[model samples]
Target: MDLSSLRFAHRFDQVSGSAIREIFKIIARPGMISFAGGNPSLAALPDEKVSELSVQVLRDHGKQLLQYGATEGYPPFLESLKQYVETAVGFRPDAVLPVTGSTQAMDLLCKALIDPGDTILVENPSFLGNLQCMKLYQANLVPVASDDDGMDPADLEEKIKAYHPKMVYTIPTFQNPSGRTLSLARREKVAALAAEYGVVIAEDDPYRDLRYRGEMLPSIKSFDREGWVVFLGSFSKIISPGLRVGYLAGREEIIRKCTVGKQSTDVHTANLTQAIVDQFIRQNLLPDHIRTICADYGEKLARMLGHLEDLAGLVTFTRPEGGLFVWAELPEGLNALELLKKAIDQGVAYVPGTHFFVDGGHENTLRLNFSNSTDDQIDRGMSVLKTIFREAK
Candidate 1:
């Protein structure tokens, strides 16, 4: 009766970051100020509208919302989402499929398109979950280098040529843990590379709408005329992360494949959430709500920027126009994780840059989340950070 035959897949054997689990444990502690989560700001969660929308959904679409939803997700909400994508993002209506969250949309794409040992080209400092998903599927993740301006298009193209990758994964808008927005030229370069190389580009854009300082850049999906990119958009940033509503858009053939894959994942996303999101959109409440979030976060980001301006030489960081985070690289020879541990002891927490990379990561790098901090807290945190920078140096 040996269970050795139940040995797990090779993909499951690799070690994971202890930092993630440690952060999870400390998150719920009282009086803890966390910059660890990449959550949309509390300013963004449309509570009043959500409550109103939920009531509307129940009053008008109660029975349908509570039932087992379609595997492709709610039709009315999907249609609304499709229109939003088409009108705002320059997509065709037939290309998008709603899912439980942007993460699930990524999962669906991975499951359908990634066979074991397939190559995945990823940003050097990349999203942890995307790396985790690729790892679970035994994807040979090739890391593409990047710079302050954001992902290096030439590096990505080189990787594509070398690996003939299964997919190129990116968080182009205010990239996670980096807050680095890809320039328009770079976006076009990468898009061209994807089209030329016959590789799929998976663009996860949850924070695309969260900008406080920058001009809008067209999405990579906007250049996806050849169906080379699968764009993932989420309501988590605009509505509520807890609701977990998101969608994926690509060529209908690829979307159809993902839909079939999703059918076996959770059957479908929760009907109640979709109904609420749909109701909110129909009532024309989303624009005002988004404006509120943008305004609040804009002030917060400004405060952080003001505080950090003096420490410019001692430390370096991205000043993202829009998005939740500002990525900082400590002066040469410092370790961000060590700085984080010291900062935590002094009543602050942030994610180290290691968690963001798919390959080589800078030890001196760290990410600060401005959306969650109060203006007073921003000052205090920066004061502590200045002390840490001096000590670490």
Candidate 2:
């Protein structure tokens, strides 16, 4: 009767813990000033056109919209996505394949490459979801140290020379939790190192298009001369998170492998949603919508950053040019999770910095989302955070 002795695979044992989910319980309290989620600015939605496009598409192709579609994903969605990737991010069209969301693409990639004990190189403080799935495969999770310039290239090279991970997973553009972008020189180093070591890189970049400031950098997929990188993107940030649509772009052969693995996962993403989304994009609504979204997020991010100046001297947080997070590190003696208890008691909530670390050392750090808050909420939140820091002092 002992289930532990029944020999369940290690992946099952590894998949259960989640940091954000536990923190979410506190944010649900009435009057809480939540800085925890990475959700986008709702004002960024092209609300006017989404309804218009949805109505028109359904009226134009009702039957097709409802029917099952390709295992690789809906044709127009893929085609529109290919055009977007090539023109906006410099990826080749044949390389991208759609998935339920970037999360599923992450799962698919891990399934495709990892065998128990195989190494998967990750940023020391990396995406929680990616960390969760990699552990599911029971792969040797090696933490690659990172800073504001993103993952350290020399450290990455050293890891490669030593461990030879099956793949190096990175959130290169406006990285989650840290809101850090990989520097151009550092990026070139990563690409060269991957190619030189025959290591595969999984470039998860859902936040590239959400830039509220600065110039664009080409995606890692654009620099894959040796077919050494697999890039993941999602509409969840730019569009509706509820839609759950995302894609993977890489060498065609590798995508084909991911596609076979994807089949056993969801079979294919929903055709009806694909048809609706495809119609909106191919027919020209997505661009206008994204522009509106960027503008909304830009303003909100500005508000948060401007107010965050209050935390200066006592703390430091990332000022991202794009993406949906702001990472802050508290004073040496404070634990961010412990501070969250005080903050939540004061009606403010945030995820602890330790949740994102692979080896778990950044106890005083925390992530904030500027996208979902109003100006008033941001100002009030910062005032509260400042009070907390001052009190801790």
Query: Which candidate number has the best lDDT?
Result: 2
TM-score of 2: 0.94
What does candidate 1's lDDT look like per residue over 295-389, in tens digits? 99888888887777878888887888888888888877898877888888888888888777765457888888888777777788788888888
Regions of candidate 2 where Cα sits further than 4 Å from its true position: 1-8, 15-19, 46-48
lDDT tens per residue, model 2, 147-205: 88999998898898889899999999999889999998888888888888899999999
Each prediction's whole-model lDDT (CA): 0.82, 0.83
Which pairs of residues have clashing backbones in candidate 1? 125-357, 126-356, 211-322, 212-322, 213-321, 214-321
Worst-scoring 10-residue span by lDDT in model 2: 41-50
Regions more than 4 Å wrong, model 1: 1-6, 15-17
Model 1 worst lDDT window (10 residues) = 86-95
Measured by TM-score, the strongest candidate is: 1
